[model samples]
Target chain A: MSDAETTIPRPSLGRLFWVFLVMGATSLGGGVVAYLRTGLVVRQRWLDDVTFVELLSISQTLPGLNATNMSILVGDRLRGGMGALVATLGMCLPGASLMIAAGFLYGAGGDGPWSKAFLHGIAAGAVGLILVVLVQLGAKTLKTFADYVFVVVTAVAVAFFKVPVPYALIAAGIVAIWWHRPRDKDVR
Target chain B: MKQLWDLAGVFAYLSLLTIGGGMAAFPEMKELTVDTYHWVTFPELLHFYSLGQLAPGPNMMMVASIGVTVAHIPGALVALVAFFLPTGLLTFFVGRLWTHLATWRWRPAIQTGLGSVAVGLVLAGAIIMGRGAITQVFFGVIALAVFLLLWRTKINPAYPIVASGLIGMALHYFNIA
Candidate 1:
């Protein structure tokens, strides 16, 4: 929709795959979005800022992981179905291979005391990382008092009551959507 | 063969539950993988998850780890395809249809509604993970320190997390924790 989409030379699907593969390998520390913006917008000029943000919004609203979804959407926009497949594969392959290796290593020696201590400590730290993510997401998403209520209800249903996630997701999602349903007096 | 199918089914199901992020499905992932399937223990799940955070791509690639643990290369391949394919298809279709729905009035409601709920899910996940992860004094301190550092600084997360592992090793070596 932006001028760049029209002006930028369309890259070949192989090129698309290679670019995304580079991104997948280098985007450390879980900030794939930032890396995406730099690669697609700043460097490749494949998409301008506005278009990049628009695609990112779609990625967030959808049910897939942000990184993979962004790759699919961007790749689809660039070169169609094959592009999407290549991009998503490129984005995922590096991490998937690393994790599989981690799995094999853990299986081999994960039960030793040293490994136990190391894993335990990393798990604790990962908890902190998750908390940071939660706060950032909450700050971005929770805008109203009622929204806060929905969050608490949903959290309680899952964490305390052990309600199944799908049930909680559906029930809370329906209620929250209806609560935010269009009001005649409301102006966007 | 049964293990492969189970791995596929479990991860495919878990994949859909990741609304806001993979962490949103953590409790359920734990419930099924650790408690139900007995594919991995709680600590092992936690370990895989922690290591996953260090991985460069999507945060939930740990599903591959679980697959490898449960079966092997076939399990790993099956898990990756299963975890990704369903949601990947959904995303592709919905993404194509996104612009056509922009003018619809309920779009904002759907976004806002799902937004808060997604946050809640992440909070619940953090709590569940914390319960298992922060069981000791040193571990708790590590969590708190990492939280504060991340909140205040722009440092890459991998450093603190790797440091946390090293600190644990050191503490164990010194018999301090």
Candidate 2:
């Protein structure tokens, strides 16, 4: 319901696809969100910062990859159903093709000691990358002492006790939601 | 054929568990793909995952790698569609409904509540992956170094990650690790 939504011109489906395709092909490393913000808000000028953040919040609240979810939401906003389709396809195509090719290559030459050593090192580096993501996510999402407790309980249950993720997600999710339930006094 | 079906079912199921991000589904993905299906060994899973990080788009696109391993191109196709389609549809419909739910009372609660749990899931994933990836002290140092560099700087992550690989190669040449 922002002015940008009404003011911005709707892009053609092809344009949408092309724009997202470029983002998919160039958003190197793991931080697709920053690249997305640059492409959509800064470069394309299709959405303002507020709208972008709002859509990003929705993307985060939902259960999908942020990059693809953002693509669908933004694409839907710009050009409706076909826009969503093309955007998701464009965003996924580059990585998908590369990974498929990687699969073939790995199958052919993966067992070599050199390849194994390199993969091992990168895997360790990836663990570092994931830790950074976790710390950043925790800072943004976690607030109260109880919230930290929820994080620990969930982590221990899953990683240590080997509790299935679904069970842990459901049990922790319900409790956390109820604890944060809107109180009548705090109506905003 | 059966392998294709298995790939579809497993990835489709796995997709729903990725609430916060792809990492949230890592442990379960490990369970099904490595322990149960034997499609790829643990080291191979870690390799694909790290390489996926280097890939340009979604980090979890490596799911296709597993599928390709199991059943070639067909497996990849099935895994991609299955992994994406259900969640894509859910997102499309829910995104439309989001505007209507803007003022709903429980909206804030749902957002905040899920946010914490999602963080926990990602943490769990990191721990599980660390167990597999940080086998040696040298690798541990690499992980910590990358963590500090990324935590403090604005540099592109790809650079440090590639350097880590090169360091590994160097170590191998010198028979250090």
Candidate 3:
């Protein structure tokens, strides 16, 4: 039989949910993408490397969290709409539950001096983390001098002028896309 | 009833702003959730965001905290569903059409353009958040140190963040902060 004809059957919806649940529960420190590649591409063979990358690019390009986007894309590819539903729920449930519990805990004790101090410290540390993420993303995505210029302009627009994020996003996005518009000389 | 509707509307709106990642939505999230609706304080928003970084799934699951703060478990469910659904449907339909558009000449342009802007938005978010997060000299030092460490080292981020929190507690005990 051809590789197409003898392909592994689609995983059951329950198994899809179970696998995503395990991934969602175990993917620590915000590296869900790596865990996802390992689980879906390497271990389970639900998708090949090329398809995984394609889905990932889609996830990144769209406006959503990568983990949930990946879950929706991958699950849909595997078992249609119901698969997408289950996968997204599985991915979100563990973390959402914890955060809800955290809300209750903070409501109760967040005003205590020690809790206040701790939360403040973590906030500062999270700033560092966000900065790191910004730098890494910049390194990967930015190419041209104009691209760097767009980044700075957009940042200043929001951070200094208080231009709303949606406005900045649209304004910068339009300019950047027009600048990079199909260059005939550099045609791929 | 109206509160839940408001929660749903706010998150759904914030959801679209998350182009690059959850951080891309931070500024608007702060504007609507903290400033507009008063569902949580700035410090509380920061706290939930920080806690979310340590959580196991999608980083933006912190929205659940805001929901719970507003209306308990049902609120949390509403927020999550609202935040995810609109973008989720977009991705589903777009992902299907993406393959046919692979050969479209403008695809690369759109990708590269959006990529840079997304980075900028995340930078903008960090700046806005920094105003609140980096209040004191010690806090600034902690942020700088964590930045350098994460930039240079392969260590997991949780260790340093948790350590920073413990140090904060100690500093407060000693009347430093």
Candidate 4:
């Protein structure tokens, strides 16, 4: 209900696990934000929008899929260790199982035209989905020209300059860390 | 055993960087699986990339192709599970922390940046992956269309993806691009 209690209102492990299971099968794009917003915020009303944004941010920083991180965060909120495990499994197992099957199919040559057709179709569609998600997120996240500029320059750097991703990441990370250093100090 | 462990290590590293989605890891993924390890050839990566793009879930699922290419069945299992684990755990912790300090120093900025970076990474990935398939005009158009249509339209958009493959196959059938 009201997550207003200061004593760290934990969600029920069982309920979160159930949600985790459902989300595993459905969540796509690796964004996991939509699933969290829909499942936890809108459908279940487990978290408000403010909470969702906060949780989403935390999920991004940690070293994993945003959805997986979300499962854990939600799980821990609800039921600590069990919640974490179930949530992880929920996000991990479905994709892993699918991958294993894909591995088998792929190993078997994936020879059929239908299979090839299916793959080609889906790949193109996925990019479309990616573009949609990108625009949607840009609306939500990048509010300024500078942010858009970063997006443009980053895309150009990778496309035109043939910048290796690791170097790009390292450069971005340094810029981010340094850029934020002043603001971080201000907040502290 | 060493190979399985190697698989584990690769997934772990990839998982860490893969922040927004599976595609985010592609550039690194291409470098590691194709360029560095030669687990698969570049053309093979394009095939896998194309498939991953088409599939419904995470494009990172393309990592499965690497597993299949490596030690077959077992390699796929190892990579899929291992790559996901660290991130799963990390997400759980971060997810919990979301209730507290998401608006705090650096968190908000980092997240905003990640959202943008994820998109950039996907585009970069497409460019890197498309170069391999771009020798022919038809393929080039398909690639460009895929990018443009994705950027421009919201009309469900699945149609182009399905149609493109038929175009490719028909091209092959007719001795075309």
- TM-score, per-candidate, Cα-based: 0.97, 0.98, 0.97, 0.79
On the 0 to 100 scale, the lDDT of residue B112 in model 2 is 88
TM-score between model 4 and native: 0.79
DockQ, per-model, please? 0.85, 0.88, 0.86, 0.42
DockQ preference between candidates 2 and 4, better one:
2
Across residues A1-188, which tens digit of lDDT does each residue of candidate 3 receive? 24743564489999999999999998878878889999998999998899899889989999999999999998887888999999998998899889999988988888999999998898889899998889888998999999999999998998889899999999999999999999879858
lDDT of 2 by residue, B61-167 (tens): 99999989999999999999999999999999999999899999999999989999999999999999999999889999999999999999999999999999998
- What lDDT would candidate 2 get against the real structure? 0.94
Candidate 3 residues B1-177, lDDT tens each? 999999999999999999989999998998899999999989889999999988889999899999989999899989998999999999988987888999999998999999999999999899989999888899999999999999999777888889889988988999999
Expressed as tens digits, the lDDT of each residue in B1-177 for candidate 1 is 999999989989988988889888898999999999999998889999999999998888899999999888888899999999988999898989998998889999999999888888888999999999988888899999999999899898999999999998998999987
For candidate 4, write residues B84-166 as lDDT tens digits. 77777666554555556734676656656666666576667656655665656666566567658756754434457667777
Arrange candidates by DockQ, descending: 2, 3, 1, 4
Off by over 4 Å in 1: A1-5
Model 1 agreement with the true structure over A156-187: per-residue lDDT tens digits? 99999999999999999999999999999988
The 10-residue segment with the lowest total lDDT in model 2 chain A? A1-10
In Å, residue B105's CA in model 2 sits off its true spot by: 1.2
Collision pairs in model 3: none
Better by TM-score, candidate 2 or 1: 2
**Candidates 2 and 3: which is better by lDDT?**
2
List model 2 lDDT by residue over A13-116, tens digit each.
99999999999999999899999999999999998999899999998988889999999999999988999999999999999999999999999999999998
lDDT of 4 by residue, A1-188 (tens): 25545544566666666677777767644435666688887998777887677666665555565656667776766667787777666665666567666667765866676555445444444444555556665676576666666667667776778687667766765565444443624654
lDDT winner: 2
